[model samples]
Target: MIFKNRLVMFLKRQCCFCGAGFLFAAIAFTGVATAQAGSSQPDVRISLDQAEQMALAHNRTLRADLMLISESKANEITAGLRPNPVFDTDAQFIPFFSPSNLNSDYMDNSAQFDAGLSYKFELYGKRKARIQSARAATVVTSSIISNDERQLRYQVATQFINVLYAESKLRFAEQDLATFDKSLSISQKQYQAGSISHGNLLKLQLQRLLFQTDVTSAQVAVVQAKDNLRQLVGFDSVPQNYDVIGKLEAPQPKLGLMDMEADALKSRPDLQAARQLILQSQSQLHLAKADAHPDLGTTVDYTHLAGNNDLSAFATIGIPIFNRNQGNIAKASAQITQAQEQERAAEQLVLTQVRSAYARQQSALQVVDLYESGYLKEAQQSLSISQYAYLRGDTSLLNFLDAERSYRTVELNYRQALATAMLSEQRLEESIGMSVPSGKVH
Candidate 1:
């Protein structure tokens, strides 16, 4: 009886251990699922303006361009500084071989010390020309940095729009799949009840597969778009599973083409940089001409020789006999011409870009308006009517499926049109080097 009791206790212990192990496993599985859910969710959501701010703060290329401005400023500072005066000291008649001839005192009989200071006086306003040239170069660098910021802003905005478009498509695909799921369930029941044929059920199943394919493609596109945006904004600043908050709707602006062109000419940083380059070249030409004049170097010296002290002063100048900066002057003149031509080219390019973007924007707006006015509503109504008719035995499965496909196509096309219009508007802003005021959407 005692042994039997012991066996019962042992069995109870075994049951307790088994229960504990099961409970542990359940907890572990729950934890894992929670972690997965959290990982799948987006860590951050940002608007277009916030995205632009992040990009400006974290973009490596933009940061590098900003550093160039500091470097140019440093050059300007260096150019404004005058040359340091030279100090000279010498010991003549030093007896290194014979210790007896060496002098213990600093100014002894057998040794002589000479010290002098020399300064080079820049002639023909050389220093002034250098300072001016450096200032002009700094202006060029500043303009370049400004242009880089503008371009970066445009890139970020475009990528942000792309992300929004991809997300919309993904949502549409999922919704379509869900609608098919309901239809598929109904079709399966009808087939089992002998109300629908096997062929019709098979067609519905195949249509579900197509929707599934679309969902997969849209998911991939979303991921790619987000990755591109993250890269532009900076990898560290954006999380892998972050979401963008923006619509693909284009905003209308009241500004005309001529106004845009005028703004572009006045505000385009690249054009300004090009013009600054012309000024820099002119300054360089003046500097080169100044270099043709010789500089004056003046020196003064004191000597203590054999207990006698003497002082001397002299000035030296180079005669501009042969090399009078002829080559540099020619090069600087040529650079001025080149800069002017480049500025003109930049202006033309800006105008062309504005026109192209305006055309695209107009076309996209038309398409979006057409879809929103009546076409999209009609497609949806047709699909709904066909679905109702099929369920009521008034239409075939083929007709219903055709309506579904048409609705999906129209919806996707509408989304694409919206994205295109938004992107074209961004391009217009970039070409004009300024943001147009947002107006009412059509």
Candidate 2:
């Protein structure tokens, strides 16, 4: 009975061990499967607006420029302040003896402490002009930053379009390859049955190879486009690639050409920046001209001589005798002329940029329309006919391959047109200093 009892307990323990091992194995298997599934899934998708926001936050270049604007603001603040006062103190010993003719055996020691406060009120309006100029310079720096942001947003939009284009091409290529594989299978059977020539079979096989090459090329393009988008948004790992569902549509811009010019003249950062420089120059000229006037100052002094102290007050005026500021006045006048010329140049340049940008935008719109209405439809028709001819045994494999190629080429061209058109519109708005409503800082 004892031996039987021991045998029963041993069997129970073995069974328990087996159950434990199975449970552990099941848990491990489940974990591995879950991990694989998670890895295979694509990343989260972001819309165009979301992408723009991300770029604004992460783009290193824009952040660097923002820092520069801060620095310029500091400089503007400094320009408004008056110069600090100067303090002087001096002590001299005359070798314990005065000069032979002056002191005549008297020992001399003297100490002087002079503290003076001086301020110029800028009676000629130079300081006010300087303050205005500094403020204008700040505006200019800010405008430059806005222009940069607009351009960056446009770039991100273009890259996003490129990624979508490459993905679309890859899908089409893969679909065509599958179709060619089936066609090649049919040709092989026909050749074996003596219903089709060996030449036709060879052609189909060659076309299959070509289609496979196309698929490979398209996949390479997709990788490259993804890398570019990643770099643009400062993403470390690849984002989940999603289909771009948006179509390019021209929105009726609320402003006319003349309106754009007016807006740009008022708000365009580059032009405003130039205007600020002109103002700064004007202020400098005022300063130079002000230098021609005499500087008036008052002085009060307390002196001790040979144990006697005396207090005196004096009003002084510097005539600028030898340097009567003639050269500076001429230079200041020249500077004013130079600044006026720059202002004119800036106005002309803004007009030219606006006109050119408008023309390009119009051309882009027309090009996109042409591709959509004409080439895209023709390419689709050609692909349909080629597909039908293959099934009917009327089209050679080479001819069908050419038609497929034409179709994909035209489709890619259409995508390119859409991307370019959007970029052109953005550029036109930027050129005209019209800010897009990007849901960020205006």
Candidate 3:
């Protein structure tokens, strides 16, 4: 109680000076807040933004997606390479049985020895076509991985909100328990003084059990929420005793559905990936057409036969009478159409998401406004009045208890509204494929 009084004193005045004063105020407030929160320091404290950054940096799933990009680049190297030359040396018609008659002239006449080197020269720019297709495919893969990052960002944000909500509920439960303890002490005094009946005191004592239950339930919720967040942020990044530092309060947002859709079209990685797929398909078609033309095989050889030495060259090519890659070329062409349709679908989905998220955000904001405008203060004031009246023998026990329950319900609902509002903002940003304007932090 004395600490809260001192905290209010520190929070009350404006800065004594400029820049330095602002820094001093910030540091002082942080220290006071830390001191007020707990006797021992937490292992770590993170805000929503920090949690998102940690998740992006340490997430194993994202690292695996990045590895796919490296794999695709390696494949590009393979696609750009040309075929290796074949070398051969052979001795034919050797007379192994006639050892006595194996003179130099007989060997030359009877044996035909040859050494040859051959290479297949690709036609229709096949190697170049392969390289283009591979590079385009890599571009597509990169965009897809970027889209994965977008999804991860959304996931991290939602989980961070969950942690914040749980913490809020836990704080409320503990604070409410403390308030009830004071009330119970007063009830005991009243019972001893003959100002309240024993039965009425017992009823108030039994209600303390409800407050204790709330605290226990809230503690479990905090543990479960943190555990779920740890899985997304990476277990190694933070200790088990880590805590999130934030409050439950809604910030007003200004967003338009049409503007959000425009941003999505420009910024959405999935949409970009879909468009890249069309280019990737076109490159594949080019590679397929290149495959229809047969490569030219050329060979040069040196032969020694009948005491004469000769050098000969040969060239060969398939007649293309049976196969011309007709099926693969047709398939590649059809894939281009498929990719185009996919891009169209992606664009439509992005717009639909923007609208849905916008509507949700609006609904959440309304609830937040409903709480903030009157219900929160009204509930607190009503509970305070009832408590004062009951202790002075001016109100019934039933009225005091009713007021306390109403206050608790209002506060819980308000916290939930705050969480819903924040989550809606996250969803909206995800639909737009970029971070929106920052809101006032409470």
Candidate 4:
């Protein structure tokens, strides 16, 4: 009995140890799993600032333009430096010698050795012109980058909002299908009980099919919109159900066409870049004119007599009697004219676009207000009454279906209005050289 008791006590201690280990492991695993899950699924909420950051980081075209701007800045650094100097030397063999073995005067023992550096100092504001041109180029490049960033931002906003619109449509389509499904079930039951005709049952079935088709189409649209957004953001994989983090609101730009045009001149990067190009061309023109004047190079010639200790230096200056660089100057002048014309054209085009976009924005805003005040509310009320009356057998099937269709149409139109208004607002923002709103979705 004593031996058996001792063994039972030992086994009990082992079981307790095992139980303690299992409890520790369970606790550890639960903590670890909770931590992992939390880290893996961070709430993917992005505000406008976040969107801008993502575009800066991930937008390929914008990034490329940014690199171009950097390159232009780099070139500007090299533009102000002078050209490197060159060293020249020459030698002639004398075949004549004073002794009988060689002639003392064969070829003229006239070899020249020049050891001097010549620099062409741009005397007439030429270098300054070049520097100004380069600075202008840099400005233009920076403006182009800004323009690209704005464009990408607009594209992303459109895709993001369109996704929301499609999702709304899909939700409504699903609801519509569910309603049809319930009605079909009731209709079938009624048909069996001789409460309705076969034609009515068939009609319900057809309505269900149509709703199903709409749902499918909406889903497809969602997929396509997601794909487009992914490409814009340079994402290879699709994101999970992204909710737009901003609410749609009417834009309140308080500027007219002339004001916008002036802002565009100040804000549009392409126009600035074109203006910079003109300056660069002007600089080149100056450079060509300077070239037309014979580039004066002064050289000091040093002569060391062979086997003698005398060293003599002589200075010489060069003048161009031919090839006076007229062609180059003319070409550069023509380029300047071309650049000026292009800048004018761009300015005009921007003005036209700003006016047109503002008009469209105004029209879209009016439509949104009209729908909100009159049409959308009426459609909703009609749909509600039709649904209730149909359920109570106080309305004909045709009337109910018509009302339902009208409600769907108005709902779709409302979503479209929201999209149009948002898109128009974006264009207007672009037109006026305004930055995107920093406001987040409500």
Name the runs in model 2 displaced over 4 angstroms: 1-44, 91-129, 235-266, 322-329, 435-442
Instruction: Please list the residue runs of candidate 3 whose C-alpha ends up more than 4 Å from where it truly belongs after superposition.
Output: 1-39, 438-442
Q: Of 1 and 2, which scores higher on lDDT?
A: 1
Every candidate's lDDT: 0.85, 0.67, 0.86, 0.69
- What would the TM-scores of all predictions be? 0.87, 0.72, 0.88, 0.75
For candidate 4, write residues 198-243 as lDDT tens digits.
Answer: 5555566556656766766776776687667767766722255443
Candidate 1: tens digits of C-alpha lDDT, residues 1-442: 7976676566566555556554554465456447547788788999999899999999998998899989988998898898899999998878777767675663476688999999999889998999999999999999999999999999999899999999899889889989989988988998899887665766676566567667667767877998999998999997887998877775675377777778889999999999999999999999999998999999999998878899999999998889899999999999999999998999899889888877777788888889989999999999999998987779998899999989999999999989988888898899888897654433
The alpha-carbon lDDT assigned to residue 393 of candidate 2 equals 78
lDDT of 2 at 307: 48
Provide C-alpha RMSD values for all models, in order: 11.8, 15.5, 11.8, 16.3
Counted clashes in each candidate structure: 0, 0, 0, 7
- Candidate number with the higher lDDT (1 or 4): 1
The candidate 1 region of ten consecutive residues with least summed lDDT is 24-33
Q: Residue 166's C-alpha lDDT in candidate 2?
A: 78
Output the number of the lDDT-best candidate.
3
